[model samples]
Target chain A: MTVGLTHFLILGTILFSLGLYTVFAKRSAIAILMGIELMLNAVNVNLIAFNRYVAPESHIGQIFSVFVIVVAAAEVAVGLALVISIYRDRISTNVDDLDWLKW
Target chain B: MNFSLLSSEMLAAGLGTGLLILGLIAPKTENRRGFGYITAFGLLAVLVATFFQYGINQSTFHELWIVDDYSVFMKQVFIVAAILVVLSAVDFVETLPRFRGEFFALIVYALLGMMVMASANDLITIYVGLELMTITFFVLVAYQLGDGRSSEAGIKYLILGSVSSAVLLYGMSILYGLTGTTTIPEMLTKLTWSPILVVAIVMLIGGFGFKISLVPFHMWSPDIYEGAPTPITAFLAVASKAAGFAVMVRVFLLGLPLEGAVDWMLLISLLAGITMVIGNVVAIPQTNIKRMLAYSSVAQAGYMIAGLMSMDAPGVKGILFYSMIYVVANVGAFTVATLVRRALDTDTIADYAGLGQRQPLLASTLTICLLSLAGIPPLSGFVGKFYIFQAVMDKGILWPAFVGFVMSMISVYYYLNVALYMWRDDPKDDRPVPVPGPAKLVIVLSLVVTVVLGVYPGPLGELATMAAKSLF
Candidate 1:
């Protein structure tokens, strides 16, 4: 039961694909935020894995992972606030339905 | 890190934060918002100090940041932009009443990011700086959360922006894994483009693509620009865009080292051409002034890319020159838009129908800015275009140059429409453009600089040439 480089990359690709699917499939803005969170986590996992497997001598990977988390938290906090306000104004978080601007 | 005397940018950041504190304590000043003056004066001081300190430190902060002509030059642009933006923003923020201090403080924070990027010698530093800029904007974009369009634009940007950042980070990790370091100079020299390195490079470019609003990743810009507060839009249209150009030139030329690749040049040239064409052509139909500027910003960005595609010192110089000119034309344009809208109390093309008769100074300034933006001669915009075209000619990219030339022609049609509408009389206004003192001062200053830079661009051109020489 050992995690390898390929395994980490596979996990990352899966998360990325899931995030992409969430962006495309989900109509709710909050759901899309989750997808972004997942994608960021995916990158984090890969960074940590690479640090463990590929470059344990340096701690930069872990540092980057921390940055991703910190940034993600900030993003989600503001994002959720925005969604709440948008919902209050428009009565929904559906992305497709939110189009007041069109040609 | 001069502990005794910090670089003025750092000083400005401290002052900006202090203002934020004061603003929270006392939201209502008697006559005018004191924080606006504080922010503007602080930035002017920073601008002066930043130049003196620019080349003083070749390698400071343990060589993590490299400050040279390039960084100094870019900082000059950012500082100037901050001052002008603050000047115009004074009137706007006074009306908002809620977060004027925070707004100015966030701008300082964003400037801090640009400083980091300007001096960042490593990918890790660049990423850190880039995030600082983006995170601040995450709130700034959605600052008007009460407005649906603003919220939608902010959310869209966050979602898409986060994805691009992740993809870019993945690229960074892969580069680190393959090259064993995230230091850009090291990676540039050591990288041989293994499968992993190549993938990382692509991801890095994609992330930058999003930031610069290059084509596919550009979907968020128009929305975000229209959604953000007006001053923030000015920041995005000028300061943020300059930051992108700064990093792009550095990372592409100094960090990545994609040399001797004709195919790469061809790809970039094609992208530049199409972006120039599409951004302008598509903008013709937009009625929202903010959104129109957003599209125009995209097209302007394409011109910067054209500079990069040249891949020579002159090409680099072209990008620098274009970036400088762009800041002048765009900030001036947006400032006028904000001013006129505030006066007329409307934000539609129709509202501006009788602007020429109403406010001669404001309307005429708008006309000058629009003409410059359209690449008309004797305006800074034309000088910028000339440099880019000259660089392309040097590189002998006939098709791309032809396309850009024609695209500029197409742009004139719509850019002129602003003037046309202002003069044609839609029966919307006989009130005249209200040229406030501050607004009048800014417009006068920008108009002079735009024209001066256009006609006798030798000095500014020299500065950009020096930047090109250093970076390239």
Candidate 2:
């Protein structure tokens, strides 16, 4: 029952699946952004676990996770800005309301 | 590391930053028209500097960055695309109420991102470059403050784009775990097929598929293309897709053991076939010109993917050559659409009635561009199609090539429908469509390049062959 690579990988996969579920199920745009952040964090967990267990001598995975965090921040910043803009226009943040262009 | 190897990237980055600073320092009363010219000329300088780096096969920064003829050639395609977009966008940008200078700056930053993607040799480098390009595009797509469609498009792009990046990164992490390295060349040496590796490859394809807008993952594209500013749409069609293909070729062909344990060719051929059929068939009914072009570009991407079926120098050469021609033809078509949108304040196909009478230059250029896209003879698109199909046939993969050929024929129907509307119908308005000097230059230049490349593709063909050889 030790917390090994398998344990971390299972945890990561579950987080990723839940995040994807949130992305698909959520109607609010902000909620979708939160789901994306969770998915990114799932990736971070996977990277850190792999770096620790599989390639302990190198720091590529750790560094990559750090890069992922920074990029996710930037993405959220832009996403929130876009959401605010949409909110201003329609007073709504529901993904369903974004039907001005035909899908 | 020889810093000279980074000269082009540095120049592009500096130009983007310098433009932002210029925006801040310049008087608000001063017109922002100069920003477009400065961006275009700066990109031209960067393009020339990239040419100087040609034939230098080397890697630096611990193999994170690479410089070779293949990357150099792709960098040129991106710069040429950026230059055309900047020039065509000058008039369009002038119409924007604010942040006009920032428009040019963001385009330059996107160009820088594309250049980095072209040269990236490590998965980390590729991820960084891809995000830089995609994030900048999110802003550019949403730049039109008054247009709700633009903001909606931005939100759609941001959500999907981030999801795709996460998928791609997850695949990369898995690959790193299995191979214990992130350098593409190193991974090639270390890779062995396992069930997990299959999962990783599928994730990677899904991620890249979204970027290139291959059929099933292509749902977001037409909406985004229709809503984004026309110039940015043009950029998205030509440059962004080219970057995706360039990196896909590198990663799939080089990083993976495609020759062993996986029939990646069969998988890719299936996707390419479906993409061609769906993209072209769906395009036939679109009334909006931007959405039509979006689907057409998707079909065009399918044809390019057909070239990848071979995974050899000839296949790679076909892709490189076709991408260059695609930049010319798509920019030409989109520039014409931009002008039409500006003059008429609409992008409908039926609205283009009697355009031949009102603006013969635009009507004719649009016809040639669309005809080229439809792969008519004596046009660059025909030659591009020829090379791609020829490469696929040489590999003895008949079905995908056949599918591509038939799709091209199907595409001709809608393309010519627009031509017919332009030439045959009566004018909705009698006013002449005024063409700006820069727009006129872009149209004529695209026309000349398209024709010249078709008539004699030998020089570029040789260059493409050389670039393709460098990859192997």
Which number leads on TM-score?
2
* Residue-level lDDT tens digits of model 2 in B173-202: 899989888999999888877889888887
The true-versus-predicted C-alpha distance at residue A91 of model 2, in Å, is 0.6
Scored by lDDT, the top model is 2
Residue B48 CA displacement from its true place in model 2, Å: 0.8
Per-prediction DockQ: 0.61, 0.85
TM-score, candidate 2, is: 0.99
lDDT of each: 0.78, 0.92
> What are the runs in model 1 whose C-alpha is more than 4 Å off?
B1-6, B27-32, B259-263
Q: What is residue B376's positional error in candidate 1, in angstroms?
A: 1.3
lDDT (0-100) at residue B277 of candidate 1?
A: 83
Candidate 1 lDDT score at position A45 = 82
Reference-based TM-score of each model: 0.94, 0.99
User: TM-score for the first chain of model 1?
Assistant: 0.94
lDDT of 1 by residue, B348-443 (tens): 776778777777677777788888888999888988888987887887777667777788898888888888988787556466555666656778
